[model samples]
Target: MEMSRALDISAAGMDAQSMRLRVIAENLANQDTTGSAPGADPYRRKTITFAETMDRGTGQPEVQVKQIGQDMSDFTTRYEPSHPAADAQGYVKLPNVNNFVELMDMREAERSYSANLNVMQVTRSMLTRTIDLLR
Candidate 1:
């Protein structure tokens, strides 16, 4: 029973990491996105936050996505006087997202997911062995 519960916990962690990775991918995909119309705001990078909560019915602690939030960092500015979205000062505000940073975050999320998976797998194997030994 304990082993099964451990598996559930690890599985939940894997799910959370998967969600984080998805958000990172989306941020990377829109890194170059800019304002479509003149004098418009460009894309803003988003981030994910996780929280742990107790399952009311099951009385188990589980991980959950707290929120999908904006980065809140200042936009990057570049000079592009000819650009349609450029401001009166000939500068355009770009998304604060950095592709390299997103990639690094993705790798970290992947490793965390993999570690949770390993935990689940090992727990399953141990449970199976215990059952066999009792036979």
Candidate 2:
């Protein structure tokens, strides 16, 4: 039962990291996305927040995605007079998403997810060994 609890906790963590990875992926995918109309706002980068929550049944602390919010940081601009999204000044607003930052976040989320998966695997192995011993 205790091992089950560990698995549950790890699963929650993995779930949270999975969501984070998804957000990062989306940011990367939309790095070039821009508004179709001139002077319209471009795509905004998304951010994920994690919070520790107490499991109702086990009372164990587990990570959860608190929110998936937009990054309000200023969007980058480039002079592109031919672009459809170019403003009156010939400057086009770009998405705030940065490839480097998104890649880094993706790496971190992937590592976290892998770590949680490892914990679950180890816990399952221990449970199996215990059952074998009991037999």
Candidate 3:
């Protein structure tokens, strides 16, 4: 049952990372999205938080999405006089999502997800072998 637990844990981790990746993609997609009308807030980056919780039935610590929160950091301002969302000073509010940072986060999430998937696959193979040996 330990192997099964390992597989379950890894599967849960993969699921959590997948969700994180999705949120990151959304942030990237909306990076240039400014306020529809003037004097409105620009798009903010969404944040994903993960938590490890005990699965009561399995007594295993599994990863879960704790929160999908908003980044409170200040938005960047660019002097774009022609932009519709420009302020009185001809400064436009830009989303807080930075391409470099988002790319790095995406890479990390992808690695974690791959590792978890590898773990689950290995566990499944081991279980299969054990069953074959018994028979």
Candidate 4:
């Protein structure tokens, strides 16, 4: 019973980290995405927040996605007169997503996910061994 609870908690953590990874991937994929029209804003970076909630059945704290929100940081501007998104001043607004930051976030998310997976595997193995001992 405790092992099952552990498995459930780890699964929840893995799910949250997976969502974080997805958000990071989207940010990376849209790093170069600029606005389609002049003076239009480019893609804004997305951020994932996690919260712990009590699972009613298990009475355990489980990680959950709190929100997928936009980053309010100012977008970088590039001087590109010929670009379609260029403004009157020949400056184009770029997405706020930074590749380096996204990569770092991705690495952290991957580690969290891996750790949760490891926990789940260990819990499952222990449960299996316990069942075997009884038989």
Candidate 5:
């Protein structure tokens, strides 16, 4: 029962990290995205939040994505007179997503996902051995 609970917890963690990775990827992809119209806002960076909840059946804490929210930080502006999205002052609004930050976040999420996967693999191996011994 304990082993099953551990597996469940690890799986939940992996799921949460998977969603986080996806968000990071999206942010990276839109790092340079700008608004299509003048004075319009560009794409905003997405953020994921995780929350711990008790599993009713297993009575164990499991991680889940609480919400996916947008970054409220101010967008950077650049002078580009020829750009269609340029405002009256020839300033183009760029996305708030930072490449460096997105890369770092991707690395962290990858590490977390790997850790959860390792836990699941180890738990499965232990369960397999237990069954073999019983047989």
Candidate 6:
């Protein structure tokens, strides 16, 4: 029963990290995305927040996605007079998504996901060995 709870917690952690990875990917993909019209705002970077909650059935704290929200940071501007989204001052607003930051976040999320997967695998192995001992 404890092994089952471990599996559940690991699964929840994996799920949360997967969502984080997805959000990071989206930010990376839209790093160069600009608005179609002049003076329009570009795509804002999205951020994922996680929270731990007790699973009533298992009485274990599991990770969950608390929010997927936009980054409030200011967008970078580039001098591109010919661009369609250029403002009156010949400056184009770029998305707030930073490739370096996104990559770092992605790496962290991947590592977390891998760790959770390892935990699940170990738990499964233990359960298997316990069953073998009974047989």
CA lDDT, every model vs. true structure: 0.87, 0.92, 0.92, 0.94, 0.93, 0.94
lDDT of 1 by residue, 1-135 (tens): 678778878988998998998899888888888897656778889889999988775678989899999988888879999998888888888988998889998999999998999998899899889999999
How much is the lDDT of residue 112 in candidate 4? 91
Poorest 10 consecutive residues of model 2 by lDDT?
Answer: 103-112
Task: For model 1, state the Cα shift of residue 127 in Å.
Answer: 1.5
TM-score of each: 0.92, 0.97, 0.95, 0.98, 0.97, 0.98
**RMSD in Å for model 1:** 1.4
lDDT of 5 at 32: 84
Query: Which residue runs does candidate 1 get wrong by more than 4 Å?
Result: none
Q: Give lDDT tens digits, candidate 6, residues 3-28.
A: 89999999999999999999998998
Candidate 3 residues lying further than 4 Å off, grouped into runs, are none
Q: Tell me the deviation in Å of residue 47 in model 3.
A: 0.8
**Pairwise TM-score winner, candidates 1 and 6:** 6
For candidate 2, report its TM-score.
Answer: 0.97
Clashing pairs in 2: none
lDDT of 4 by residue, 60-85 (tens): 99999999999999999999999999
* Model 6 poorest 10 in a row by lDDT: 97-106
Q: In model 2, what lDDT does residue 124 have? A: 89
In model 2, the Cα lDDT at residue 58 comes to: 98
Worst 10 residues of 3 by lDDT: 35-44
Model 6: lDDT equals: 0.94
